[model samples]
Every structure is written in C-alpha cells, then in structure tokens.
Target: MNAEPPPPAPQWAVPPEGGWTADDLDTLPTLPPHTELIDGSPVFACPQTVFHSRAVSFFSGHLLSSAPPGLEPVARFTIDIDRSNRPEPDVVVVRANAVESLRQTRFPASNVLLAIEVVSNDSVTRDRETKPVKYARAKIPHYWRVENHDGRAVVYVFELEPATGAYTSTGIFHDRMKVSVPFPVDLDLSAIAPRPRAADPQ
Candidate 1:
C-alpha cells in the first residue's frame, strides 16, 4: 500500500478572540510568504518591486559596511513593540550587545537604534504615516524613509524628540547623503535608480 500524503495547512486558523501574539505566530505550522502579524492579525507584506529590492540591497550593504563599532544593520527583522504592534521594519540598525537577548526571531524595540522603511506604492500610507508614529512612540532613536522621486532616491532622516516621543525630520537627501547622528554616514544614492529588465523571448 502507498503511504498517506500529508495534509495541507489550514487556510485560516486565527486564534480565538484574544488574538495572535509573537509566541502564537511561532507555533504556526507554516506561514504564508511576506507575512507580518499586525495587532494580533496576519497581514501579508506588500510585494516588492525590482527597484525596491535593489534599493534595500544597496542600503543594507552600505550601512553594514560603515556601521560604527557595536552596531549593525539588520534587514527584514521583526520588532516586538507591544501586544498590539509588532512591525517588521525593512531594515534596522541594532546594538550588537543585545543580539543574544532578543528572541530567536524578533527584537525588542528598545534594542533598535534605527528603523528604516522603503516605501512601496501599496504601503505609502503605512510607511509614511502609520509606522513612523509607532516607531517614535516606541522610543526608537531614529527612523529613515527612502523613496524615489524625479528619477533619484530621496532619503528622509528623522530623529526622536525625547520629550514628545515624536520624530523631527532632520535631513532630506536627494543625491549624496551625509549625516552625523546616531553615527556618521556618507552614502551615494546613484544605484537606487530602477534598472531596465531584458525583454522576454518571444
């Protein structure tokens, strides 16, 4: 006799009223791709455009290579802010010393030095409006938003206002970006231009 085939994963298995937590998310047998738990509900991450991936790759490489001692950049990692908010930033700069203390899959907001978001058409409201407020309230020291405009990458850098727990826009970069806050970083943004894809064979 042939062996039985494995069962397919449940289409919908949200927990009963209380909502999904990080612990519950970990217990899921299989999660859909590009998924994030939002306020105890699962929200699929926005699909990435080719340009988006290239920009992230470029920024990650640049930031990691030049990061100050005891700090490093992490991409596509979840930050546990609270029961209601656990956003996975596109990239985050975190303290090296706290890497071990973070849960196997997620970091606490307190450990994050900076949180970054690469804006997608579908995520403009969330990235530009919603998440910034959340990160600022979480007391993250810095936040960066990257978007392309007029055929060039634009970076909006923000710093936290400790008293208000809000972010103040510090610098906006259109070409070569130079800043000294949290740490000094000098970056060239030319590679952020969207590349042309080869035409498919007819």
Candidate 2:
C-alpha cells in the first residue's frame, strides 16, 4: 500500500511588522520545507545530493556510537543562533545535562559543542565557506565539513579561537581519522562515501 503524504508545510514568509523569531517558529503547527531563518528572513535549504544524505546518516551513526557518556549526537536539528538566525546543522554534539531539559524544537548555540555539515553541490559554499564563519561567531567550539574527494569522504576539522571568534584549522582528514577535542575518536571515512551504482545491461 502507498504511504500517505506528509502534511503540507506552513506558509513561510517574512512577517509584515517585524521578522521571524524562534518563538514564532515554536508556534508553528507544522514546520516548513527545509527552511532556515537568517537575519530574520527565511532561507530555504537546497535539495541535497544523495551523497550528502548518506554522509549525514553515516556520521551521525558513528558519532553517536563513539560519543561519551554525557555527550549526545543529534542530526538535522535546528538551533537558534540568536533572535534572527536559526540553522539546522547536519549533526551536532551536545551536552546531555542541558539537553535533558530541552523540550523546545530549537536549542540555542550555547548548547552545541560541535557542528557538522556534509557538503553538496548546491550547498558547497554555504557549508564550507559560510557556515564556519557563522558557527564560529556563535562560539560553537568545534566545526566539521565533510565532502567527497575522489569518491572518498574527507573531513575538515575546525577549532574556535575565542579571542577572535574565528575557527583555526585543526586538521584535514581522509580515510582513518583519529582525534581528541570534544573526545577521542577514530573514524573510517570510507564508511560515509557512497558506492557507485550498478550498471544496467542490455
């Protein structure tokens, strides 16, 4: 049997008086389609490449497994950066102590320890060049950018420099990745890279 379609997303537009806020988002009966709030305006997220989706799932699964007792990994969850901007990161690692009380649909930047973005063709610049700057400004301690390189998954790790509110390049990793920042972790990059599709025959 065919599955029922999802309910329609709420009409997303700028308010006539002020702008969209986190509180306004909470009042939403149904969320909009891949919408992001930037500077009080709605910016719809681009359609993702299949590889992008795979990497998000792959990293989320591994990050969860390797997460420490008090840290939890959340995927595709919205975070309120301030009164104006709310972004949905591909994955974020947060403290359980704070998250235990989080009933709201979106948490603030203060709750996030690490943010990860899987780059797609449409979102390449946003994920790599743009978000790192924003995440750093919000004081997210760590940031990661995952992309496909020669059919292998590569990760670029960043650490926040609080003094300047900028990220310092920690490492660029491909294949086996070992690190200790938020916590110690050993990751196999190939696990996230999508396999080539099988060929059709006549």
Candidate 3:
C-alpha cells in the first residue's frame, strides 16, 4: 500500500462581522511573521531576496548613525498608522522617546519621522503606491523607497506636504543619496552591493 500524504496545514479564517484590526495582529498566533495590516485586512510579506536583506541592513545602519539627537532608526518594526492599518516599513526613523518600552512591537505613526521600504518583486504595488498614500495621510513626514536597479540600489525619496496631506518626490538618487529634511541624511548607495570576501589567509 502507498503511504498517505500528510494532512493539509491549518488555515486562519477572518471573522464574520468585519476584517482584522491592528490590535488583532498582536493576538493572532496563526498568522505568519512580519504580517502587516492594511485597510482592515492582513497583508503578508513575501520571502525576502538577498538584495532586499542587504539593502535593509544598509539603510538601518546608515540611518541610525545619521539621525539627530531626538530621532532614531529602527528596523523591521510595524507602525500603527491607525486601528485598521499597521504597515511595517523596512526601516523607520522615529522620535527617540517613542521607544519607551523594550517589549513594544509597534509604534504610533505620529512618532514616526520617516519610513523606508526596500522594494522586492512582490512588494512593488504596496511600496510604490499604497503605503505612501497611507503614510502621508498619517502625517509621517518622510518616506523612502529603495529599488534594485541593474543589481544596484536606487533610492526615491518623498516628503509629505502638510496642507494636502500627500507625499511629493524630493529626489531620486543613484550611486549616492543626500537629503536635508527630517534631519540630514547622506549615504553612498553603492555600499549596498555585496563585496567579495577576502581570500582565506594562505
């Protein structure tokens, strides 16, 4: 007799009356890690690529070092944009005081000064279109979208316009990146490329 195949994995079901809230994200053990809430729905993150991982690290390190006295950089944390939306940007520059608790998994959007997203094959729509609108409407002042261009990182920066509550592109940077809003930032984008490991000592 042939061996039986394993039972299908369990699935998470949405509630009957309404979609998920930001608070539900904290309690849902069945959901995948790094899941985000958008428009009352759960948005799962696709597997990250090598380029995505390297770029996230690059931005986190540089932003942390470059942040001013009252601001700080945090990586892979969700921002509580509202009760219904809690999108996790790749990196966020937030007010230092917002990190009051070590156990906190999410920060309020009001405390976020800048949000950065490293585009992957699966995140193009959210990173390029959806999240920016939400981030701006929430009054997060700065946003950066990093894309892999010809095996190199290119950054597109945006700043929120207070009156209209929307983001306007500040610059598109390749090879190097420099900006002066929400605290000065200057980065060498080329460093995001992987360097060859030194030959093992003979």
What TM-score would every model get versus the actual structure? 0.86, 0.83, 0.91
lDDT of 2 by residue, 1-202 (tens): 9999997655554363578875666665455666777667766667777778888988899889999898889888888888878888989998876575557566678989999988777777788777788899889999999888877889999999878889999999989888998888899888777677799896
Ranking by lDDT: 3, 1, 2
**Per-residue lDDT for 124-189 in model 3, tens only?**
999999999999989999999999998899999999988888999889999988888887778899
**C-alpha lDDT values of all predictions:** 0.83, 0.82, 0.90
Candidate 2 TM-score versus the reference: 0.83
lDDT of 1 by residue, 78-155 (tens): 888888577888899999876885557888899899998998888888889988998998899999999978667899
Error of 1 at 12 (Å): 4.7
Which is superior by lDDT, 1 or 3?
3
The 10-residue segment of model 1 with minimum total lDDT is: 8-17
Worst 10 residues of 2 by lDDT: 8-17
